[model samples]
Target chain A: MNQQFKDYSQVVSQYIGNLPNDGGDWLVAQRSSAAERFTELGFPHAKLEAWKYTGIEGLLKQGFETLDKSPEFAEHAVLNQFLPEPVAGRLVFVDGVYQADLSTCDAVGITVGNLRSAMAASDRTVLEAIGSLSGVGDHGFAALNLATVHDGAVIRVAAKTSLEQPVELLHMATKSAEGQALRSRHLVMLETGASANLIERYVALDGVAYFNNLVCEISLAQGARLTHQRVQHESPKAYHLSDIHLGLQADARYHGINAAVGAAWSRTVIHNRFLDRGASCELDGIYLAGDGQLTDFHLDVDHAVPHCDSRESFKGILHGAGKAVFDGLIQVREQAQKSQAHLHNANLMLSRQAEIDTKPQLVILADDVQCSHGTTVGQLDPQAVFYLRSRGIDEQLARHLLCLGFASEVIDRFESETLRLQLTEVIRQQVRG
Target chain B: MLTIKNLTANVDSKEILRGVDLDVKAGEVHAIMGPNGSGKSTLAHILSGRDGYEVTGGEILYKGQDLLRLETEERAQQGIFLAMQYPVELPGVNNMTFLRESMNAIRRSRHEAEIDAVSFMKLVREKAASVKFDQKLLKRSVNAGFSGGEKKRNEILQMAMLEPYLAILDETDSGLDIDALRTVADGVNLLRSPERSMIVVTHYQRLLEYIEPDHVHVLAGGRIIRSGGKELALELEAKGYGWLLEEAAA
Candidate 1:
């Protein structure tokens, strides 16, 4: 039984047939076209320029099929760590299906609920926003997510409202989905003058091999602001892929951070586009890959309007035989004058067998723009290590301190104190591992 | 407390410290002054057991133990502290953390209990105050973004905190104004005790004016050619090192 030869087209059709028709003909047509696009494009491969460094052969060989029904999970308590004490909202999903009994939505100035339920009432705004951005660039993974996603979060913040707490979405997988595929889709919209903080975390209850594809579409109206943080701590045997798309209007701001501490092979692609003028954004990320794991972060920022600014900083600490890849591209169009954009990628190879491939690409067509990009891949500074050792710190402890210090610059940028401290512990464990 | 006999060392396959000899007793301060390329700093590094300097000849004895046989940390644990000529900046390790860890390392080697955080904080603050060092900077990264004078002052602070038996200050007055030099000298002067010895390595006699060394030696060609009392420093300051280098060669 060859895994790669199994037919996946039937699974796509079956997923589409199982979806309710309450969304009218428009959603049906959108899903049909998305399935067609996925079938045509298929899974991304290393031959593709955008994914030249990462190989998806292992993912394709898993022979994944959409999990039509939620499977039984005995470890319902696995979502405890992700559920902070004083959160504005919490949504727990297992295998692309919302677990209603385990979720709570008590936030003010916001409407948070299951995506499928929100879409069933023919919410034209929800459908239009989801359909417009899901498969915009013909990305195969995004198309698959749009075509097969069954349940996720639908959050809308009202205008001129500010939330004091963060909304968290916990996406977990159980061992029952060993050979199945999970696709989750999220739509977050912020109206004019609205502000909120959103956190999305991924975890796995068991160390089983599965394919998880996620797609999130975000829209920020004029004068809106959103702080988004994404954490991926999947099982070491899991294959994870996420596509995040963000659209910013005039004077809108988006501060995003994507961090990954555990995964066999995980990739997060973030695409941010400035649709109006005076929009600014800060995109920063950190990845700690150990024990032969692989992590990648791909970012693309488009400055289509004038007076927009974008800053990106990414760092990776790779130990064991782990490997990491970072590719960031900031593009400034002809009319986007005074666009200040800087992109940087730094990697600390903690072991001799660890590897990293990083590139910071800048494409500026405007003459009055300030754009720069740089990449650094090196081991910890030997001089700094010796400095600590000379102070009587052992060589191993010195190395650990240097590695942690190297990672602190990126970790300290998170505004949320709780998340920052949690990620600090995660980084410490990775360094010591 | 310290003795080096015909100590020959090489750096990068080139002979740097060739047949150097020096001796210092307890409670005494020895000042080794020399021109450039005279291996003044090399001797300091050799005593502190820094890597990349191969000691090809001779031996160093501290308290009847072979100092060259120990590792850098081991030498540090045995109460040999080297205040670097150019201190390395560590961007992530906090100053107080480094100080506490160093102190614990020394204590652990001596089979003593490690100090707790509260007591360690008190100790560091006291030592920092004695050196006139700003305690607020201790919360920042170790010597990161510190000025030259501040780095020198930090070295003195470490000396005060550790209270080593043999303290070697290598060019601690370099790149410092008169005021900063006085502060650093005062810090070093306060650390002097009957049970401790110090080696002041410098290029000029200005620092000696404040610390008042007991013995002075002119180092030329990796060897101490002239050894005398504290008056030798005044003579060398008046005549400069040109005559000493020529006389040593002759």
Candidate 2:
């Protein structure tokens, strides 16, 4: 009885029971095994070492119910705010269902479609890459996402092909998802010498008090390059969790940026693994946590090959009673010599109640490896504010400018010019108060 | 343009400016020379509306308005500029954006139409060239990794851009080399006109050689002890503040 401690695992089992019998038989078997894994893992609690700083007790208390049948959604004009038209490729998923009518996918040198279709068609790329890399089992969210995920975007680029325009996948939660759990999975595969850019955005259209669990797995072959950008603007009353796994082969380059500006309680986990030598990864992120918000970013970069480099920098602006956590690990194997990796997390607290729990670790087993991890938790500099104020900038606007300055370093690295300007303005509005 | 009626201030309960009195007319350049430990910087800071100083007594009048009532930025919008001895380094902040935002903030406060990017760029380039400021540096973070001389020159460049009516140079020559000093002085000289007044505070007379002041005052024990013309600075250079201290004591 003591071993059978009750948790959300039973609730998730009930969800798996009601899951629709769709997709290929292989997916049903995969879902069954994932459910088994979830039963074994249960749910993450503060007692676990990795869950020491972030506690999902609030998420558990939400009593989320998974969609029993296909969800119903009414497209609102507000969705247009997230969907900027004229995109090269666009996929919109609402309430765990992909809307083909709302998507304009140009599958010229690539395969871009939703998971259910890819799974029904027995696409080998999607079948092999879905849950292959998120194996650390650090948390139960990945397994839950796998057990119930019905729909998401799948992108596969052929060798020697470079995408001229970026592909965007927007996941929106609608009224039917309110007080319910939504699961989605994405798989991106780049062949040798292939290059493409993708942007994944999670937004709350109408639903509040919903739970969004997502897993995105990206694999790149030799000499491949991919730029992946993620933005989370979930409703302030929603709980969001995501796992982004990256596997890079020889000479592959991966550039990723994660922007989190909403969600009452959110945690983003980024796992990077280098399969061969000469691969490099640059990951940057920024999160704005307002009062009553808890935003956490967890990262793990595994360097198993020589001559690989990785740089991870995440910044946060915490105001009012906001709290944040940044946990990053950079590990270099014994043979992974000449590997250079640096991880930095900087947070600015606007109020005394605002807090941050940051732990950056560098595990170097190779003698010749260059590895570093650092964290900086600071407040608005009074001297800097005085300097700006002396230059005729009011105190309020001075603080706002300084806050924007702290956030722009990462925001500027976002790939698209329009998105960069759009995100900057959004950040400006948030920091203005 | 400015008047100080026996202005006194304290820092942490210790008096730094003890009943200092000064008056400056439009177009006049007043050099406030003092030895170390005097309240030269204190007076400059008070006039610029910097915090951390308690106004123990006395008052300051700028254009007949109670200067103490205005905020730091308000004084700036009202045409008061202080070239700090140590300019605060703001990392991750684009210097060009900082300048333009500051310029527009002051302009908007003064009921002047805001300057657009194109015009601001043109004006800044012209002023930056006049000050010998590297245009490349303007694109970098504000004062981040700037050499000592570059920082001072950047300050003068900002002063030129803001076009302040009353400017205070607080130890502008402290860390400058000869060439840097000349460039800064030249920038300052270009901004000199009948509509503007300046207060140049320095410990050495090196800066005075290039930009001659109409009146020179020796500050000792937190108050102006002596006031004279440009020849007074030459006299002080010939014989350090020892003679002036003795004369003031006598």
Candidate 3:
């Protein structure tokens, strides 16, 4: 192996060894295996098709300082700005480590605990699916996250339980020093016949250069329904890489919405696998990038079994000199016959300097499947702008209103009113700025 | 209240309006009757400052100011309103929100205190009822999923709310039934005042029976070929534009 690969493997091994092994033997073993695979494949380059748009050379060259714990920082007002009233549970993490004293989980039938506590409690069900949905070490960051998986939340919804209130997971990053690197791992599982809503927010507290590596896996059993939402609003000095892997069983329903607004350089990967028939999934995403921000989304929907349906739509607005990349793929395996899937991606470039790259792909092996993919990139309709302006709305307000209307198609899909409004404000700020 | 002097405009380098001149005083409704492709819509679009239309020559004056120099919204705030022939659908922006924003914008430019939400809702509901629009339409996106008639009624409802000094109804009667056209005309008539002027542009004379104009002009080949009192619209409907075209050529 090369010297760089050797150094990376050593760091992974050392991090794993330092983890407390109290009843977390299985998790440790999984991490070690994942680490071995990661060591074998250090970092992906331009050669890899999936990593073509996102280059990891900057992350590798800087050699981030490992951040096992968070430093003391003032409470961010934006943190509590849009928190839903009377949430069933709320967990706050700073730089991957949980701050239990500031957390609350008062709702019945829903338990929100730190991953460390759950691991030490030896929850076999949680351990079995820790890194299972993301699969074994296909991506370099997934492997690296599994290796240094120090702290995050373990959200459990009991069987036959239905949560009236949403559960919030806030992952915050505060720089103790420049070049700090934080890694977080979250495992959430919904038992049979359980239904719940989960909102995860990642915000940067400091504007110092840092790297945030996060991985979350979700598993839903038969008749389980989950609404998962992720919002990334990091500082302009931060680099974020997040992965979400979901698994659905028979009759399971999953809805996911991802909003990427912050971070100097960010990439989000969402991989969803439907394991059985009668599974339904709805995925929606919106990314509003302005100024010098670089936002990228790579999503994949795999239909492994027959008689499933999935719908995916993503919209992006690039302003100023910002750049955005979207690569969405819907794959229907041969055995997944009678599957129906549709994928659409649209982008609005406000300034000529703004750039967007979109690729929508569909690989259907089953002749009985119905699948379609489309992408559109253009500026705001001048006719629409003029129409609004003629109604006595100023040019700036007219443009803002037009852009809001453009993004509202996706924002209106949210069932939660509070989250929808919060997202609207975020979108407005991004567009106006 | 409004004056157009030898105005010429082009869209995409193709001339649509060729030296058109007309004038309308307060308390008078001037109807411009023209065949399709006769620069009828282009005139309305240019008056509203829609992009892609280059005003090659001439000028428009509103209340003695250079109207062509003002921005679309600025002209709108100065009491100019254009009821689009085809209203653009805005999905996700609620009717109430759009109206409030427009009302506030005009009010702000006029240095008037903004209306609160309660007052705004009351005004909107009242105007909505005056135009016979369903209250449920206010909850939906602006003109989204609305039928053709409903979209026109929505525009009239907006006119009632904004209460502009000069309202330009651009083919507002095109897709409406008899009842809908009556409601729209009634709404426009109710807002008519000595200080408010109107320009009703339509190709058909059937709408004239509902919203009677004081003066009617025949716009053929990008110019007003003839001008007369309200009876002129009826004469055009009876004789058709072919005779008017022959007269203009002569």
Candidate 4:
């Protein structure tokens, strides 16, 4: 084998060697499957259309070491310091492994446990659905995550259960003296008529180089309502790759908000499939990039049935020498008549050196569907700046207010008040920095 | 209280206000009536310290200081307020927050205590009601989606809240209905005092009917062609600016 393939195999072997005996079979199978796919796909290059804007050349140059399970790392306060007080059914993960003892999962009529325990339990419904949703054929990191993910979290909501508070999933990565690679997989299923809000947060501890590969799959049954928020605030030395796949049944409502603020190199892929009629989905995102950071988002919303509606809006604020890319697609199948979809992507370039690439697309095979897409990239409005400055606001405060206003439209859509406020604070610190 | 001597300004290399000289003492109201492209708005913008206007000649003095040297915010802190012809809509910025920021900025410049939220809200509510503005407008974003009349009323409400020593109204009655015009004029009239001054710039003399300027000036081709008492506005309104331009050319 070549050096690259050898390195990949060594990482997989390290993760598989550490799996507990109780859940060794499932871990071995998943790791082998993922490794085989990784060997076939290898690292993504500019040749791949989805990875066109974000080439993984630098990530491949330095092969990252797999991180060991460290429950003691949960003692770090960076997660709770930035987040608000924990809501109900809160789960915390340290270095890719779930920390169930420190989490709370009461009053939701749902079960939340570590991925290993859930995989070994009598109910194998969660494991059966893993990798069942297609469309990962071209995504290299997603296939790699499926191949080697050992422990994350599994959450299942029974029928007709309505959660009073949002479930918080905190993923913390603490880098040791030697850099490490962390992979995790999360599964979430809401049965018929179940309603809940889920917030997944990722934070990197200390200032060391690391790589994180994460995959999250959510299944919403008939009449199920779910609001999912993903916040990425890792250290500047970290590289993060995440994929989110969602499937919605009839009359299901799904709302997802992503706030991407930190990391040196980060890429997020979001695939949402509306399988049944009358289902609605909305995705709102905000990304802030500055200095040497590179942030990329690839999103696809599939309307597989008739009368489904979807709206996608993502905004970016780029400063210094940072670069950002947004590729959003809305697809309506031939049989999906009467479908309605809208996609808008806007970016604010705060510095002359900063750059943004936005591509909004619509592909509809149905004759009776309404679809529209738009993209805008520009600097702050000088007239608005003068208007604010004329009112006695200084230049810095005026610019700050304009930037805050730019992000407030997306931030206001957050379902959790605490998360909203916390995200606002994060955006403020980022803009001020 | 304000003086402009030989002020020649250019916007984008095209001269707009050429050798314009004007003076207004305390306790006086001056109305400047001009035709289109006659630099009426340019003068208002220049007096308010807006950018993009190159003052190639002369200087403006306000309260014995060189006003031309100050930035827009500095002029604002010095109690100079301009009611824009078309108020820019600032989405996501609350009206109350904008007002409180302006008020406190001026207060800070004058070494006065800043107004807290309660006091500021109370002051805004009172001033907003005086302009007959709906309370809901205060909660909405600054001028976002406001009707023409509502936008003008919002400008007047801001004027009342700021209570500037020198207030310049730039076509404040352009798009208002009769009721809105009356409310806006009433709001302006209520704020007039012996220690304060105003320069009302408009294309027509209709607004002068309600506010009643003490002096009227006809500005043509970037200069004040004629200055007379309040009756000058009536004569100009009756005969139209075409006759005045003809007379000036003759």
True contacts kept of each: 0.61, 0.81, 0.80, 0.59
Q: Which candidate has the top score in TM-score?
A: 2
Q: Candidate 2, residues B1-250: lDDT per residue as tens digits?
A: 9999888889999998888889999999999998998999999998988888899899889999999999999999999999999999998788999999999999999799999989999999999999999999999999999999999999999999999999999999988899999999999999999999999999998899999999999999988999999999999999999988998889
lDDT (tens digit, per residue) of candidate 2 on A1-433: 2233244566656766765565463566667778778777878888886788788878877777776556676666435755453556888888778888877766577877898888778887677777788752446677778877767888888999988778888888776778888888888899999998888888776647898888888999999999888888888899998888999999999999889998999999989999999999999999988788999998989998899999999999998888888999999999999999999999998888887888998888999988888889989899999999999999988888888888889988887776677777767776533
Tens digits of lDDT, candidate 1, A118-163: 6667677887888565453357777777777777799899998898
lDDT of candidate 4 over B1-250, digit per residue (tens)? 9999999999999999988999999989999999999999999999988888899999899999999889888888888888988998988777887888788888888899999889888888899888899999998888999999899889888888888889999999998888888889999999899999999999888899999999999899999999999999989878888888988899
Cα lDDT, all candidates: 0.85, 0.87, 0.85, 0.84
Ten-residue region with minimum lDDT total, candidate 1 chain A: A1-10
Higher-ranked by DockQ: 2 or 4 = 2
Task: Tell me the lDDT of model 4 at B214.
Answer: 93
After superposition, the stretches of candidate 2 with alpha carbons farther than 4 Å from their true spots are A1-11, A18-25, A68-79, A82-86, A135-138
TM-score of chain B of each: 0.98, 0.98, 0.98, 0.98
**Which candidate should be chosen as best, given lDDT against the real structure?**
2
Please name the candidate that would achieve the greatest DockQ relative to the true structure. 2
TM-score of chain B of 3: 0.98
> Candidate 4, which segments miss by more than 4 Å at Cα?
A17-25, A69-79, A82-86, A120-123, A134-138, A175-178, B111-113
Model 1 TM-score? 0.93
Report the lDDT tens digits of candidate 3 across residue range B170-239. 9999988898888888888888898889999999998999888999988877788899999988898899
Q: For candidate 4 chain A, which ten residues in a row score worst on lDDT?
A: A74-83
RMSD to the hidden true structure, all candidates? 2.6, 2.2, 2.3, 2.3
Error of 3 at B164 (Å): 0.6
